[model samples]
Target: MAEKVLMKGNEAIAEAAIAAGCRHYFGYPITPQTEIAAYMAKRMPKIGGVFLQAESEVSAVNMVIGAASAGVRVMTSSSSPGISLKSEGLSYMAGCDLPALIVNVQRGGPGLGGIQPSQSDYFQATRGGGHGDYHMLVLAPNSVQEMAQLTIQGFALAEKYRMPCMLLADGTMGQMMEPVELPDSAPEMAEKPWALTGTGLSRKHNIINSLSLTPDELERWNIDRYARYAKVEADEVMYEEYLTEDADVCVVGYGIAARVARNAVNAARAKGIKAGMFRPITLWPFPKAALNKLATTCRAFISVELSMGQLIEDVELAIRCSRPVTLCNRTGGMIPSPEQVLASIEEAAAKLN
Candidate 1:
């Protein structure tokens, strides 16, 4: 039987990670996402799991890497600045093909930006945040309920693909409370044949390192990783559309921005404006197909975001620039109100007409 619980999005993620068989967690506390670490600290040891607060984000992610290399389900989480610090570990994890879950409850960016919720990391998560040509599976959850679901799904996908899966969220979603039906504890997965556990008599010693001395070897590694990414792009894209059928305008958004956009769509509908929403759940393997289809029907697209035009560019690319994509956004900790969204929709509709 499933249990309904009222939980903050960050708390739900911590609980869901435990239910998903993640017994190892390492993280540093950062704004708007600190509840996740706090929840883990309280709940992890009670379940006989280990939760460690490392000295810094770099060490925290490296700890996750160490745990994952030992074949344990491991996770780490942070906001934007902390994630920036962890990018070195992220790149190394990618190179080693380590299965880990790293949640970035995104906030404003560049430097020691504000603690307010922001989706400014779209480029960072989609295009490799760190150096080197590698990708992380980036999942964006628009609601607290989705925060739980995607965190569990993220672990499974990471293990299956031997890659890091990131749950990219923002402050609004992280701090908001919502009802969620928790998933049951997943069955213990069988041993991974490819994991870097001690190699016995059957094979040679396994070493996990990102450094490649030769240029040819490095180039070949890049090609191989990209091939894996291409497969993910084909199989892993996820999104949601509301009132898209017969709509003249589509609002593109994800994370909390999607929820606000939905409210605006509802307001637009009440006024007889054919406005709809197209939300990309997997921000990295973006929902290009759905957006392209909407382009054929919708006269214009409005991108609602917590940052200025980060996701708007992707919408433009997906639609092949056949239609204009307008930006409706707030930055530096400000959230766009439903009224603002409604106004944006009205403006877009007028422009299209």
Candidate 2:
């Protein structure tokens, strides 16, 4: 039997990556997320893995690109401000189809926001933070267990899709502690036949780059990438529904806000209000089909977040105005409460009746 241990979310992410066979990690120091780099530093040496603390976030992500191109499993961790610096590198990884893991223990954003947890980076993670037509597979975990499990799985998804992946966790999730049962052993990594390891005596050398200087070639490359993105969307859309079947109002949220919304649903139900919660586990795919289906029945929807209604855009897009969707959020490091979500639900439900 695997022993369960209480762990903070950020530390869990680090251990989980190591257990997922990640032998290399390069990341700069950042608030609310430094634990990830610290853990890697403490453990990687014992495992004979490379744990490099680069001079800056930009340097760190670029190093990851170099390592990943050589066919090694690699990762990087940062908060919102640091992530912004790495955006260009993230874009390059996407363009070249390199598989790497990027963990953003989100903090208030725009610029050196704050160390406190915040969801302000929702758009950047889901909308391809870099300047290109590529999408990174995003996993949003609301619990310590999922934090570890998702960290393990993010690597596989990135390798499977041949692209970078972001594990979008808020500061609260990273700082909080909970019991988690980690994997018994490192997961088996796929063979990188396309990796640029070496061609010593191989028939041909492997090339990795996001650049296609020719316009027509770049267009073809982009079109092909979108085809793969569509496939990922079809296969990877993930979300969780809580008592939404007969509810009059559905509250949609993720991460910490989702946790609060769950409590709000329970309280609303106790008060005889038919309310439910929908958690989008994958922020990217966004689970449009399931949400659209729910919109056909629910009287209204409330999109909750720790940011000023950033997620509402996706919720509105998902429902296509089939139902009225309102936002209940807090920004600049403020946390959302269950009472606030319930109030928003009551407000939305009132509009319905």
Candidate 3:
């Protein structure tokens, strides 16, 4: 049997990145997510991989862009404020069609907010974080184990789509410790024929860029990218439907909040409420089809979140007004209690009476 070791979520993610063939890690120090960089700094040199502590989050993300363009697997991590600083670089990577992994171990924020857990970066991750019509592949993990698993998978998804993939984790998930089994070997990387490695008389030099000075050229690029996004939406939507098949009250959540809602759902079921949870594993894809199917049978929805009701909008949009959606959440680093989510579920069920 594979050994299961206790590890912090941040450390687990760093080890997982290495296991995913990520040879370069560029990051600046930030709370909640600093451990990921620390782990990389400790291990990357020993493994012959690069670990660069950049001057700022912006610099770190750009460093990832440069390394990724050179046909190497690379990653960067930060918290909410740091992610905000890296937004421009993220957009640029999307435009250039670079495959890279980004981890935002989220903290409370609008500005330089608290160093505690928060899910407020949902908008930044699910929507286009920076300018233009682009979306990063976003994965939300509910546990420390899933943090490692998703980090491994996120790298594959990014390489598959030739886009940046983000693990949208909260500070609690980053700092929390749990048992996880490490991968025995790194996943093999696919060749990047278009990578900007030196051609050296074998072939023509490759140019990796997101710039087009001509209007028509830029329009064509945008259209082509949108077509790829449409394909991604079709093929990559992922979710977990817990007791939703016969549910009357559907509770929607993701990441740490999903873990909380799972317990609330069990409690609701014990109390004779037909409660369930729909967890969005892939946030950008949003699991709309599954939610729409359940909306046909469910009476109401309760969105459990660790932010000021950020996931509620997506839930409402997914159900398309077929069922009323209620918000149960806490913001500014406060985690929602299972009892609070259970109360929301019961209240939604009572609305039918």
The deviation in Å at residue 167 for candidate 3 is: 0.4
lDDT by residue (1-353, candidate 1, tens digit) is 44688899999999889988888999999998999999999999899999999999999999998888888999999999999999999999999888899999988877989898888988889887888778899999887888988998998888877899999998888999999988776745646776677877789877777889999999898898888888898999999999999889999999888989999999999999999999999988888887998899888999999887889989999999999889999999899999999998999899876
Clashes of each: 0, 0, 0
Q: What order do candidates take by TM-score, descending?
A: 2, 3, 1
Summing lDDT over every window of 10 consecutive residues in candidate 1, give the lowest-scoring window: 187-196
Write candidate 3's Cα lDDT for 231-336 as tens digits: 9999999899999989999999999999999999999999999999999999988888888988889889998888887889999898887889889999989999
Model 2 segments more than 4 A misplaced: none
TM-score of each predicted structure versus truth: 0.96, 0.98, 0.98
Using lDDT, rank the candidates from best to worst: 3, 2, 1
Q: How many backbone clashes does candidate 3 have?
A: 0
Local distance difference test, each candidate: 0.90, 0.91, 0.92
lDDT of 2 by residue, 1-353 (tens): 54999899999999999899898999988889999999999999999999999999999999999999999999999999999999999999999999999999999877877889899999899997799898999999999999999998899889988989999999999999999989878767778989987788856988897878899999999999899989999998889999999989999999999999999999999988999999999998789999999988887999899888789999999889878888899988889888888898888877877
User: What lDDT is reached at residue 152 by model 1?
Assistant: 89
Better candidate by lDDT, 1 or 3 = 3
Q: Provide the lDDT at 161 for model 2.
A: 86
